[model samples]
Target chain A: MYKIAVDVMSGEKKAEELIKGALKALAEEKELELTLIGEYDIISQELAKTDFDSNRLKIEKADQIITMDESPVKALRKKKNSTVNVGAKLLRKKEVEAFISPGNTGSVMAAGLLKVGRVKGVLRPPIAIQFPAINGSTLILDNGANTNCSPENLEQFALMGQLYAEKVMKIDNPRIALLNIGEEKTKGNKLTKASYELLNNNPKIKNFIGNVEGRDIFSEKVDIIVTDGFVGNIVLKTTEGAASFFLELIKDSFKTNLLSKLAAFILKPYLKKSLDKIDYRQYGGAPLLGVKGLVVISHGSSDSTAIYNAIKAAKKSIEENMVELIKSEFAKNEELE
Target chain B: MYKIAVDVMSGEKKAEELIKGALKALAEEKELELTLIGEYDIISQELAKTDFDSNRLKIEKADQIITMDESPVKALRKKKNSTVNVGAKLLRKKEVEAFISPGNTGSVMAAGLLKVGRVKGVLRPPIAIQFPAINGSTLILDNGANTNCSPENLEQFALMGQLYAEKVMKIDNPRIALLNIGEEKTKGNKLTKASYELLNNNPKIKNFIGNVEGRDIFSEKVDIIVTDGFVGNIVLKTTEGAASFFLELIKDSFKTNLLSKLAAFILKPYLKKSLDKIDYRQYGGAPLLGVKGLVVISHGSSDSTAIYNAIKAAKKSIEENMVELIKSEFAKNEELE
Candidate 1:
């Protein structure tokens, strides 16, 4: 069984919603062993509501709660029993194969970096955000946090992203595309321009598809899309905002009048299917790539469905031995250099 | 009558389709005189196909054409008789109140800056692209070109975007917001962090709504949204790409099977109505704001509807005396500085 630690005190609902999701994950995957790190009473009470097997579940007692809005690094230092820090420690100690959180993202990353440590020379870790494509989805790196990034950081992002796609996403030779304003090699800002050259020259990164524009992110033709953390975050947020705004607009439009309401009623399932194709809940959370252990961070507002899928992602990442693959990839490249 | 120069030999179809759009514009607005700039024969031939009033129209002959793929600066220097350059000259010469091009964006900006010149002390000219919002629409600035920018550029963007929104978009004291990854003041990279401070400190900018995330761009609460050109362009292209991809996917989904086809047929009009809310054609082309003379650049794939709307926009900009307003706004700010 693959062991994964769940931070049950993170996100909006604290232990209640998170434990409910973890129980669902535990019930769904028999080959999964999960330790819910939070207040034992709150977690066990929430678990009492579900008819899940206790054999696959364990609740680690904790006295304090780290709210979502607390300062990340400070909270990590101060709150020893906080789910984010505790879970990171569990992963660091090899008590768990993976660490999953629906909490303050920066805190998790800080905990992962400070407690769990990096994979030796992993310069900067990137969050590989999954955006729905026409067929499957595109893995965009350096998505959340890491506001400023250099060309070398982007080069590492490409390397880490490509290996993750190859090993975890299980694609045969993923097509790595650099995000830019235009497809031409000379089309981006100073960072993208320099990174493009680095990406092309790196023999380890196969199928470097030069540069791709914003619209090409969901084109399904590309697999791993790489960009600086700043641009990547903007693109990620803008895409999310557009999707939500449109969904709300469509929902509002359907409520205008009786005929429109009837039409909306008929089109509900199909429209939902269409919207669900781009749904974040289905895709689960973003994987913080380049960490020593598997760390998947979900949106703070993630529900049971999101939590369930994140766990599934963790199981898959462990099964694929993604961390070992990344370590070897970097170690081999270091030798070549 | 407001005079506007139309680059007839620009974009995909050259004169034929462009003249068709111009003729439609002429038909819609009677207080407009249009100069079709291209080879005389081509313009007259396209005009002859329509029953346009010869008295309100004039054909200015130009020998060369700048295809979309040509290098922007080089094309501006070599092709003197090109429609983009000639049309810009007409505006510079005060022969036309405005210039509209549905061709290469860089070429138009090149001609506008090098030929027609920028407004006095106008630091960076931003392209204001309209996006549909919950209520009306939002004007987003620095949407195309200008790959690298500083906080000062973004500050200029907010000032210019606010003034343009006030005088032209006609929303009194438009709400100006800075685009960032997170809404917090300290949430962006160095550029945005500095820009946020500059925006808050600028006294000329009224209704400064602080930092807004990517998703908030479409919210009706915002009037004018500002960002560095690079991030703005990525957001713009990503939004466009998402719209196109979703539309295509919906179309493909509707045609999947007989049941879906029937459902699609039943919900066809409603779907189009919902999708049409986000359509770019209704709003017309983006105005290259902060230039001396009004210049509007449309998408290359713009049909007659888009062309018609762009011409309409040009007429509106001239009527608003947009250049004079921008000149005074800058003059006022210079005194404050």
Candidate 2:
């Protein structure tokens, strides 16, 4: 059985909704087993409303909940029984193959680093998120984990991102590209400039496409784009903001008059269907890669459906043996060096 | 009369369209005079098609044209008589109050730095562009000029961006904000964490907001957002790309079925009107701030209308004495230090 730990508390949604998602994920994947960490009474109360297989599911009590605004370090230090901390401990103790959380991103990352630890030869763990593209999805690494990074960190991110894309994402010979201000190899700040040379020279990285601009994130040109967390986070949030801004503008236009409002009503279903490709929920959670164990960080405001998808993402990571692959790959590279 | 030099060559569009824009700017602002630098024959031929004031418009013959793909440094050395070079020379010689170009952005910035030079006490010149906001607009500095920046560079961008927002954008006591991943004062990479203290501690800055995320770029929160050129450029281009991607999706949605097509046809006019606020053409060109002379960098793909609005933007800067204000503000700060 592929055992996973789910942090049922700390997200914006109620624990009941998150439990419903966990149950749904259990129902879909027969070989999957879950240990839901939260207030035992609350989990029991929520699970009482659903029909779940008792053999595949278990409950672990954790009273404290880490909030969105709390400092990651402080929360880690004080909230020993929090859902995120319990989930991390589960992964560290080998009680679960993977851990999933929709709580604070910083907290989850910290817990993953401190409790679960890094893979044997890994330098730093990076959050790799997939952006919906014209064709499928483009994977971008170091989404917000490490704000400042060295060239070696970026090269490692490129390798790990490529492995995730090839194995879990099922892209063949994924084209790896550097996220840069300009497409030219010579056109970047100090970090990207030095990173370009490293990425270009690495024989282990196949199809090392030189550089791509922010606009190319959604384009079908590249499979994986790597950058420091600072730029990646800004690009990710900016794209989200810009998409919402345009959608709002469209809605306002539909309210201009009676005729336009009627037209909007008639076209609502089609618009939603077409726009689903840009929706974040469909892509599931961002995986905190390079850690010793699989850790998936979902959006804080994720609903049951988003949570369900995130669980599926963790299942895929576990099935693919992503952490083992990363460990062995880095071991091979170190031997070669 | 405020004399301005126009680089009639090097943009993606034909020179005739650019000359037409220059002529329109001259017609609208009677006190505005333009020196159009391009091929003499083409300028004369295009001028014959329109009825323009000869006294307000003059042609400076330059046979060479800088292609978009040409290296900026090599182009500057080889194509000495290119339109951008001639325009920069006019600003340097005090023959024009301002210079405008729709050519290669790198070429324009290089010429501005090598030719007109920096303002006294200015460390580096930054490109400041205004993003279309829900209320008015938000000014973001270091758009693409200096990719790598120190904390002091961002502080200066704040001051320069504040001055432009007040003088050119016509806002009263513009609020300056640092673009960061999080809103907290301590939440950022090395550059932003250090820059925040500097911006907050500076007494000359009238209103310094703490921090804004990428999602806040278009929100009606603050006036000026300061960031390193690398992050700023990515945000700018990512915003542009996301907007276009969504618009394309909307268009595709309308073509899904017969009824949806009818609705789209009915809503076209209103959609265009409401979406005009997000249009890049309305914003004109980005100003290269902190330079001793005014240098406005228009988009490479700008058409006649965009070019016309850019000239009007230059006219406003001249009327407000924007360069002089920045000079005096920095000079005063130097004395205080």
Top candidate (TM-score): 2
Query: Which portions of model 2 miss their true places by more than 4 Å?
Result: none
TM-score of chain B of each: 0.96, 0.98
Q: In candidate 1, what are the lDDT values of residues A1-337, reduced to their tens digit?
A: 9999887777775567667777888888889999988878888788887788888888877666667678789998898888888888889889998998888988887887788877866788899888899888999998965778888888888888887788778888999988888777888788888999999998878899888889998887799888877888888878877777777766665666676677556666666677677888888688887778988888888877788888988899899998998898788767877
lDDT of 2 by residue, B97-186 (tens): 899999999999999999899999889899999898878889999998999899999989999988888888999989899999999998
Candidate 2 lDDT, tens digit per residue, A86-197? Answer: 9999999999999989999999999999999998778989999998887888999989999999999999999999899999999999999998888888999999999999
Candidate 2, residue B307: lDDT = 88
lDDT, candidate 2, residue A336?
A: 82
TM-score of chain B of 2: 0.98
Model 2 clash pairs are: none
